[model samples]
Target: MALHSASVNSKLIFAPAGKESHGQAEQFTRGILTRSDLDQTSPIWQFHKWFAAAQRSELVAHPETCCLSTASLPSGRVSSRMVYLKELDAEGFVIYSNFGTSKKAQDLSTNPWASLTFWWEELERQIRVEGRASRLTREESQKYFDTRVRGSRIGAWSSRQSQVLKPIQGDAGDEEDDGRRVLDGWVKETEKRFEGEENIPVPDFWGGLRIIPESVEFWQGRQSRLHDRFIYEKKAPTEESVQEWTLERLSP
Candidate 1:
């Protein structure tokens, strides 16, 4: 059974009684977004501009973090998770993950379409990217893999991501029993396997997935709930190597 909003609201309580509006929503005054503000040439150039601003802002932390959303085919069950944007080029945006067992990989196998959402609340801005994802070649993936720390490289080899973990059987009250130990043991084994080795090989199951965007949208918040939105959509299917984009404004 679902609870009504009134019932849910009645039971909610916070610190400092009578201070209902202490941290309430405020009118957005950061800046206005307009059609003229967007880059005429390419959305990637525009994204670079906003992203550089985010990187420069003192209030923004981990600007590369974004929500990656994927939907499984047939049933179309959607799932989303936070992932770091590792690399971006003229082609697309790249993120690394376990391609063998992770849920996103499973979804991508069945449905190549995916979307990424980046929200910077402090800046009152958001960006949405919808695209088709494909795995990067082993050589390309290896290049990025080589840049990761030793622990992370080992972790890539250790973890069978999205797989259910089982703790050793024990009495219900046994505090020592833990499912996480299974992963820790795998890590220890991987560590020993590469001991004294200067370079660890990138696991075949882990690599980068690049999202080649078909459309990208930029949003900026405004007062009175009226906001600004601009979207860049692929012009059309073409055999040409270089893709072109058509920009338009969306009603708030």
Candidate 2:
């Protein structure tokens, strides 16, 4: 089911056969972003500003979500999934997950570079981050882990992140093709293991991964498709020099 059309005045007016055109096309005149609007010192600071606006806007939901992408080695196959942004610090952005069996972990094992994309459509803004991913210290991970609800913590320990789930043979009728029982059984077992325990330890295979950005780009949509873009690139530091970032305007 492919609905296609050419853009007129930068509005994507979709035309599908035997149907009326979809919702009214909108021109992106929400805001005009400029270089001076960004923080001169750090991309992190600028990101915080935009992030705060997104959080406050009624039009945005789940503003902390972003697309995380990784590429497998040798084959160079790329994979992406939506993940919640768990924390941010002076160094970079952080998210937590099973770092053992997940495809992302496997990719990171071979290639450390990864990318994150945040698209706030209602605000007509996007941000791209490219960085090297490294595991957060166990102690640091525990700090975030302790904040999770009990069930999520149990889930982190119960299931292998990316493994295929196959229902046990002869355990149920043909209707159970999805193998959800296997997951339910694991969850029940995990629950019993920690029946009355007040505290749960973070699994060794699960924790936080922080992406130290080499480059961060901010984009804002405009009318006529002439978008605004700026990028902050990290610079290498010498023995006597501290780290620094250079900001440059990008052609949209």
Candidate 3:
């Protein structure tokens, strides 16, 4: 007997044994959605308060950014990620990343405009920001890095982010070593290799970026999909006059 198969139009549905099926799967996810159902307040300050409270629990949250940042790599492709919001004040949202990192840094060099988004799953809240990025001084970066635990500081040195990793011969058991052990081992090894060095220096590649907001929008999700939005916009600065910010309510 001979093996046989049937085809529908030009596509084949069956294949020989051991052949694997190839296709893409649909993805579905849900969140409390905003719709045209609830009463929206004219004053946005009310929603802003709620949004700020939801973010207060964690400085580093996903779907959050000091602002939206887009960068074009050397390969001419754009990449984006949620960078940690390190500080926020009257000035704007503050964040830090390596100057050598491929995303926002390179783009900031040419174009400074950026945007950020914050979404709270539990409370059904979201905040969007548009801004310009400015590099923080080395002093500021060093100050923040110094405040970090010693292990974090060492990890900063060990991680060459956005770079490939190479497999090497070493005791795999070291993978389970604690931060203190790794730091101590690195220090001892450095001292031995460098003829008794006393301290390890901070790496030059690490630093921070500060995003100055030009506009900020806060969103609140309500029952039946009606959502609330409030936006703050700043006027451009002039030589004789300082920039000013105004708040407005937006239709959901």
For all candidates in order, the CA lDDT equals 0.89, 0.90, 0.60
Clash list (residue pairs), candidate 3? 35-225, 67-115, 67-116, 68-115, 68-116, 96-208
> Stretches of candidate 1 above 4 Å error?
1-24, 170-174, 237-241
lDDT of 1 by residue, 59-129 (tens): 78988999999999899999999999999898888999999999998899899999999999889999999
**How would you encode candidate 3's per-residue C-alpha lDDT over 105-143 as one tens digit per residue?**
677776777767776665666778777877777787887
Best by lDDT: 2
lDDT of 2 by residue, 49-143 (tens): 99999998978898889999999999899999999999889999998899999999999999999999999999999999999999998898888
**Higher-TM-score candidate of 2 and 3:** 2
Model 2 scores worst on lDDT over the 10 consecutive residues at 11-20
Candidate 1 vs. true structure, TM-score: 0.89
- Candidate 3 residue 95 Cα shift, in angstroms, is 1.0
Write down the TM-score for model 3.
0.62
Instruction: Return whichever of 2 and 3 wins on lDDT.
Output: 2
Q: What is candidate 3's local distance difference test score?
A: 0.60
TM per model? 0.89, 0.88, 0.62
